[model samples]
Target: MRNKIITVCTAAVMLVMTASCGADKNMKKGEKFLAIGEYYEAAIQFKKAYGKTPPKERDKRGQRAAKLARCYDRMNSHQKAIAAYRNVIRYKQDTPETHAALARLLLKNGNYKEAAREFQTVLDTLKGNRLAENGLESALTAQRKKEEGSRYIVRKMDVFNSRRADFSPMFYGDEYDRLYFTSTRNEAEGDELSGITGTKNGDIFYSEKDDKGKWGKPQTIESGLNTEFDEGACCFTPDQREMYLTQCTSDPAYPRYATIVTSNRTDAAWSKATKLDITRDTLSSYAHPAISPDGEWLYFTSDMPGGKGGLDIWRVRITGAGLGGVENLGEPVNTAGDEMFPTFRPNGDLYFSSNGHPGMGGLDIFIASPDKKTGKFVLEHPGYPLNSQGDDFGMTFEGPHNRGFFSSNRGDGRGWDHIYSFEKPEIIQTVKGWVYEMEGYELPAAQVYMVGNDGTNLKLSVKGDGSFTQVVNPGTDYIMLATCKGFLNHKEEISIRQTDESEEHVLQFPLASIRVPVLIDNIFYDFDKYTLKPESATALDELVKLLEENPNVTIELSAHCDYRGSEAYNKKLSQKRAETVVEYLIAHGIAKDRLTPVGYGKEKPKTIRKKLTEAYPWLKEGDVLTEDFIKQLDKDKQEMCNQLNRRTEFIVLRTTYGMFDEKGNLKNPPKPAKEENKHDEDEIFDIFIE
Candidate 1:
């Protein structure tokens, strides 16, 4: 009986010791976990410590509460973090950092009035605090925007989402029938739980539409692409022949390193993955692959050195040549916080997510406008429904329009991202172009090439009626060029704007035939001299650009003189003038061999081309500007004839200049004359005089 009493007393003593050490021991453990960035485990220990501390122990209780608040914030539990921070303030242990942090959390939780009050409290204590000032302004602005409401219609993509994370939706295929996305659902191919999210590893899944136009259940993609490790944030090449994705390989000792991998698509199956050789640095992470709309640039998020901060958006050339060096998108796009998930609209406007820039809270989606003059990106929040206090990112558009799917953790307290569809109905801008002959008929075989200031370049094939249509984005400037085998190029400038309210724009290209002498207007030399005048430079510069575009053609740039000078003197002067034009072409990077200077002094007089003849049928072929002819015409007609006679023109010497093979034969033989276009003698004529 005495031994049993002693044992009971010992047990009671041990229990008392454990209780006495409870709060301090848990606090120490929490500190260790937080130091290692294991926030989920740290939060649990911190909460336990905070619960055990008594209300009278103000210093210890405040310490535990502050730590717990920080842990919750790190774990993405902003609401809980806010409550714990308030507890810290109640216990009189709030510091400037704590007040600022609480204010940010309030802003993120959409408590604008409370957030502004908290920021003001900090500002009152800590004078000249830029962060507090900015926080106050941001909170007030966000409140006003929230009151204004949003124009976007946002809806949860229920059919494609799961209880787990589902994000980064990519639309593919010619008909946009297939939808590919990354998910962490239980059925994902991986059996191992992720150390980061405590769920199954990410895998690529795709959904297809049936005859009813409803998306079917998503199926795991092929094994070659989806693996046991984290694989996600995929993008396809312009031709859909290749795919690039982010693959994070895990390590037990070190942090997981996210690397980009490429897989070729062939025979309706993907090949084994190969790591994209971006850089030799293995310590940094690269993820969230985004191929530019043109497919020439591969943009991704990276934490590599030489960045502005934590994770900056970077790009590299991924054309046929090897991958180029990574370039960081600096400044406003990147701050001391993370900037990630970069995607582009067809118009080259960049959409990305950032926590650094001021917004509602967490990661907010922003549209970055490219400033051509500064070579920097100016940022603007997408606002409200599209951007919330939660982590909103990984946006993909349904082609070039405004309706698209994006991933967000908004409204879900657990920080699990899910896909949402957003649409803003507006008039779709389009460009319809016509490439027809300047005078006679439409050139069915002509092709139109469009180049835009937004980095859009495409070759548009014309229909049987020499018409082509292309969808264009608003606020873009485009130069469209039309070209045919036997015709000189024609160019038209087009500008599309949103504020104009005009839905459609029409552009016309009037192509001129190359078989006849094509006049180069506005080209005039100084009186009795071969030197080109300043006014003539614009026309000559255009000729230089034309030569650069049509590299396969050799041309004779000939100058003609009026019948005022002697034949010998006129010939020499004209030859010098032609040589001067040729010299300008060569100075502007045109090949010297492609140009031939000729002088047709008084030998080749003006003959009305089809355009001129149609406007003035009285001017006939083989007409010359002799003294007798000058006396027979009226004053205006005589001046017109003289002006036409003194001109410069380009004659196509050979169409096969650079098109010949090693054996001096045309690589592409010319089509039959009838197949090209029927030449009518009544319509086609040559004018020359001596």
Candidate 2:
């Protein structure tokens, strides 16, 4: 009986050893697979091993759970991964690794607040975990930003709902009280799946608001323009007679390409769509169409070869033939990230969506100001509430209304995407006007100077066509001045009242021609000396006004000598006089940088005795010229000859403001100031005759 018992014990021990070896082998294989990124297979092996483990091996169960969580995370089953990570935390209290993993998962799921708390807990439990500490700080910061964003009052509009997906919304409202948008709802007439995402196709839909401000049910727009592939993103001309939209093509020969199409509305029904010839095969894709307020320009997004990255906003002039060649919007607006869905408000401000820049998540809407000079767009992200860690895009403004619609996937009870109407806070009134010559010509490129009530000077450059626009707060009076070289500077008061017109105020400035030399209105000299005296302060002030008025105008200061002094001494004195005027101007605010002083001495006299004699027979004179004789000369000749001796004058050399309008009409002509006859002969010798 003893021998038989020993045999049974030996067999039992052998069986136990065999089972243990098999379990060890399986565990090793699972770990190897996990290290090689075979998470699905590894999880299976780990599950099997755990099932075979003895009940007393509780640590093995926890290990298996942790491994399974990693596998889920690798497989992108974030919810399941999070649950597994929570189980690891339950079994291993205060463990830094487990807390870190859980916190990261929470953050990925957009649960920033919870993630922040978890990270804080880990930091409190352990020290010297720099990575965790940094992560905690980031999570807390994101939580604060998210909270702030949620405070804005957003009006929800369930404009479209699809069993599959509805996205990329574009809004257009009309005087007739109707709103239009793009959707991929089930009721849309198109193919089942999108060629790009292999999802539901997209179409255009519109809704109307009643007199009570309640939105009506949305319905698909039926038109030959919308194709079976994809058609969405519509913008209307200011007149609302024409509409611009994007049409996608799915053929592999034309993968990811979209063409801009236009249709006219007549009798409340849209005409057949016509494809614009602007699209080219070399362009990978083109989408998101927008038309300028005047309908002179068409803007869209494309992934052409020269784009900054995945997609970039481009614009082209709309002409009779078709859209001109596309031009890329570079830098600040177009980043390495995808930029799409461009819209233009009636105010001429640009709005678009981009993922190329840092934001909460996905794509966020951004605003850009078209820099007419550089032909570039300056982009600015609407931070916080206007943006979120979710895709917020497709924004449009209703005419003159501060309230508008935008699409967002933000957590506002809508599953993934929804349309929301938001009221933009009160914006300050802006003053925009054009400076032109009195000849009814528009000066497209001129420099504008705005003097605030506090005397602060703001300078702005006009467009190439001499048009100037500026933004100013209401309740402030501004001194608007436009200036250019060889033209009279313009000054006017622009009073912005609470009731100022929202449309651009058209102010046509008529500048007189600066054919004659303008007197240094405030310049003063010592009794008989050419030196600039302290009293020149007044003249310096006037010069400063001129300079501030014409920020881009450059002048040449010329000093002349009277017949009283010897030629050499007069030359020296005149040179000194020119330098003195330059110094005064520089002291008063005129950039010394722009003044070039020269002395004509006795050369190039304003009035020649022979010319004066011929013009006016009364000037039958000798070497000494009479005041009346000088005055009788031509204005240019009289002004030139008057200073044949001692005087200073200015001639415009360069200008920031252009002289002509689009039609080549002179702009900003100088007005002649009234003249006085006081010093008689001395005055004539000082200013006119020598």
Using TM-score as the measure, the top candidate is: 1
Runs in model 1 lying further than 4 Å from the true structure: 1-13, 19-71, 87-95, 121-132, 372-375, 431-448, 451-470, 473-690
Model 2 misplaced stretches (Cα beyond 4 Å)? 1-108, 111-141, 150-152, 159-176, 195-199, 252-254, 370-378, 412-416, 427-495, 498-690
User: Which lDDT values do the candidates have, in the order given?
Assistant: 0.79, 0.65
Residue 223 Cα positional deviation in candidate 2, in Å, after optimal superposition: 2.6
TM-score, every prediction: 0.62, 0.47
Worst 10 residues of 2 by lDDT: 681-690
**Model 1 over residues 138-222: C-alpha lDDT tens digits?**
7878866656667888999899999999999888775567889999999787687764556788998999978788899999876
Q: For residues 1-690, write the lDDT of model 2, one tens digit per residue.
A: 999999999998787677667767778877876654456566667667656666455566567668877776654456777887776665563267678777766765678788778877788877755546645654656556666664345666665545434455545443336777767666777656552333456777788777897878888776675667678888876556788888875553322457777899887788878877776564566678888765678888887788887789988888777667678878787876578988876556888887556455446777887775674667765667777656677877655444578887666322346677766665545565666653224555456666666433565555434555555656677767676654767666777667534544566565533554443434557755676778777756656666666666778888866555577877877787889888878877777768899877766444333434655454443434445556667877665555543556777777644565887776655445446522232221221110
Error of 2 at 191 (Å): 5.8
